[model samples]
Target: MPRNVTTAVAGVVITVCAVAAGAGAAVPGKLGTRDGYEDAGGPVWYWPVWFPIFAVALAATGVFLATRPAVHRPAAAVAAVLAAQIAGRAVVGVRDWFNADGAGVVDMSQHELATVVTVAAGIALAGTVAACFAVALLWREPARGWAALRPRSLRLLVAGAVVAVGVPGVIALAGSDAIMLAGTVALTAALPWGGGLAAAAWLGPRARKVTVRTVLACAATTVLTFPVTMLYLMVSHGYDVTSLFS
Candidate 1:
C-alpha cells in the first residue's frame, strides 16, 4: 500500500480507538464511578474535561496525517503509542474480569478500574505530545524569507519565555476559577503542537521562508507555556500533576 494511504488508515484507527476509550471511561458504571476510586481524592481534573481534549487531539492528529502524508513516519509512531495504550487498558480490564473471586465476582475495585482507565488516558496524552514533537522535526525545512531574521536563537528563546509567562497571567486575569480551569485544559491540549512548531523553528535553516518561520516561532512560544502553566498550578494553586490521571 502507498505510505499516504497507510498513514491515513492508521490515523483513523487511532482516532476511533481513542474515542472509544474516552467514551468507555466516561460511562457511569462500576468502572467509571468515583466512589472508592483510588486516585479520586487527588485533584479536581475531571474526565469530562480531559477526555474531550484528548479526543480532539487524536482527531486533529488523524487529520494532519491524512492531509500531510509526508508526516507519515511520525504519525505512525503516534498511532502506535495510542494503540498500545488502548491495548494495555483492554488487557488489564480482561484480566480483572477473568480473575474474579470464588463466587465469580470481579476482584478489581472501582478505584483500581478507574485508575487503570486514567493511566491509559494519561499515556495517550503524553504519547500524542511526543509524537507532535517528532512530526515537527520531520516537517522541518528551510524557507527563503527566514534569512533576514537576525539572532534567531535569541528570538526563539524570548518567544518561548513570553508564552511561559503570558498564559498563566491571562488566566489569572480572567479572575474566575472555572475560566482558569478551562484555560489550563485548553493550554494543556495545545502544548504539544506548540512544542512541535518550536522544535521545527529551532531546527530549521536560518534563511527559511517567512510563513514557516512564523509558525515555528509561534509553536515554540506555545510549547514553552505548558511547563510554566503546570508550575504555576503546582505552586500557586496546589495542583498536583499526578492527579491528572486520577
Candidate 2:
C-alpha cells in the first residue's frame, strides 16, 4: 500500500478506537441490570457490543502482522493504531472501575471486562508483530498451487477455494434482533479482493491472469455466504425461513 493509503488506514483505526473509547468514557456508572437498562432476556446475553468491536480490531491487527505488506515502512502505522486502542480501553476500564457498584458483585465484575478484552486484543497484535519480526514473512497475496491448474479451470477452483472459508459472517449479520453481526465480517468481504488478488498474482506460464471474471465468481459466492448465514442463524433461532418472504 502507498504511504498515503497506509496513513488513511491508520487514521481509520485511530478514529474507530477513539470513538469507541469516547463512547465508553461517557458511562456514569457500572453497566448492569441494576440501572434498569437491561435484563436476562435481552440481546446482551452476557456480552455487549464492545465484544464485537474488540474482536474485529484484534483480527485486523493480526492480519497485518501475519502478512507483510507490499511496502514495509507502513507497518509501523499499525502500532499507532494499537496504541490508540489500548489508551481508549484504559480509559473505559478506569471509568467503569470507579463508577461500578461495589455493593453489587454483578456490576463489579464488569469493571475489568474492558481491560481483559483489550488485553487479549493486545496480545494478538503484539504476538503477531513479534512473529513477523522474527520470521521469514510471506506476502499473503497468492495461495500456492491455485495458479498451477489449467487456465480454463482457474476460475472454478481458485475462486471457489478462497471464497469457501468466509461464508458465515455474511449470513449471520442478517439474523433477527440486534443482528448476528461481528468483527468477522472480513470473511465474505474478502472474496472480491482476495480472489481477485490471487488470480492476478498467479501470472505463471501455465495460466493467464483473469481479472473481472474471477472477481464476479468470487462476488457471487460472497453473496451466497450472506444468505447462508442468515438461513443458519434464522433456523437456529427457530425462525420460520419462509416467513421472510411474507
Candidate 3:
C-alpha cells in the first residue's frame, strides 16, 4: 500500500483503539449492574455503531502491516487478537438482538440486555489488550516490523489519541446522568477529528515522502470526513448510538 494509504489505515487503528479503550475504560465500574443501561450500555454495546469502521480498519492494518518491509510477529499476533475480539463482539451483539424474539418483537430490559453486551465487550477488551502487547513488543524493536516512533513521540501519539477521543466525551457528560450516553455521544463527536489527527500524526512523516497533500487528504478522508458522516446519522435522525443491533 502507498504511504498515504498506510497512514489512513493507522487512523483507523486509532479509532478502533479509542473505541475499544473507551469501552474498556468505562466497563470496570459498571459491568455488573442491572441499571448500567445508558453510559455503561453505550460502552458495552457500542460495537454495532463502530464495528464497520473497526472491521475496515483492521483489514487495512493487516494489509498494511503485511506489506511493510519488515513484519513484527508480536504486533501481528496482537493485531490478530484485536481482530478476533472485534469480530466476536460483532457477532455477539447481533446474537443478543436475535435472542430478543424468535421471529417477532420482544421487549427486554436494558439490564438484561446489558449483561449480554458487557460480556461480549469484556471479550473485546481481551482482544485489545493483546493488540497493546503487540504494539509494545514491536516498539522495543522497530525492525521486527513494528512501526517506529521515538519514545517521546510514542507518548505524544498516545496522548493525542486520548485527548482527541476524550475531550468531547467529557463535554457531553458534564450534565448528564447517562455516562453511557455521554461516552457514545462524545465518541460520535470525537471520532472524525480524533481519528484524523491520529492518522496524520502517525503517518505524517511517512507521508511527507509521498507528498504532503496526498497524505493530508488521506488523513482527512479517513479521520475527519468519515466520522462526521457517521455522526451525522445520530444527530440528524435521532439515531440511538446504543442500540446493539441497529
Scored by lDDT, the top model is 1
| Ordering by lDDT | 1, 3, 2
Give every collision pair in model 2: 171-229, 171-230
Q: For candidate 3, write residues 27-112 as lDDT tens digits.
A: 32222233344442322223333444444555555554545525433224324334443534434444544453233233334564
Alpha-carbon runs more than 4 Å astray in model 2 = 1-110, 127-136, 139-169, 172-182, 185-246
CA lDDT of each candidate?
0.44, 0.39, 0.43
Root-mean-square deviation of each candidate, in angstroms?
Answer: 12.6, 14.5, 11.7
Q: What tens digits encode model 1's per-residue C-alpha lDDT throughout 1-246?
A: 475676666565555556665665454323222344443222322232333444455556566766776645555434433333233333333333333322333233556555555554554454444344334434434565677344345554454444545555566676676564444433442233233233334443532233234444334544565576456435422346677678
Tens digit of lDDT per residue, candidate 2, span 96-166? 33433354423423434454445434433443333233122212344556654444445644654454344
TM-score of 1: 0.38
Estimated TM-score per prediction?
A: 0.38, 0.26, 0.38
| Deviation in Å, model 1, residue 130 alpha carbon | 7.7
Q: Which stretches of candidate 1 lie over 4 Å from their true place?
A: 1-6, 13-17, 28-45, 48-54, 60-64, 67-157, 164-197, 200-246
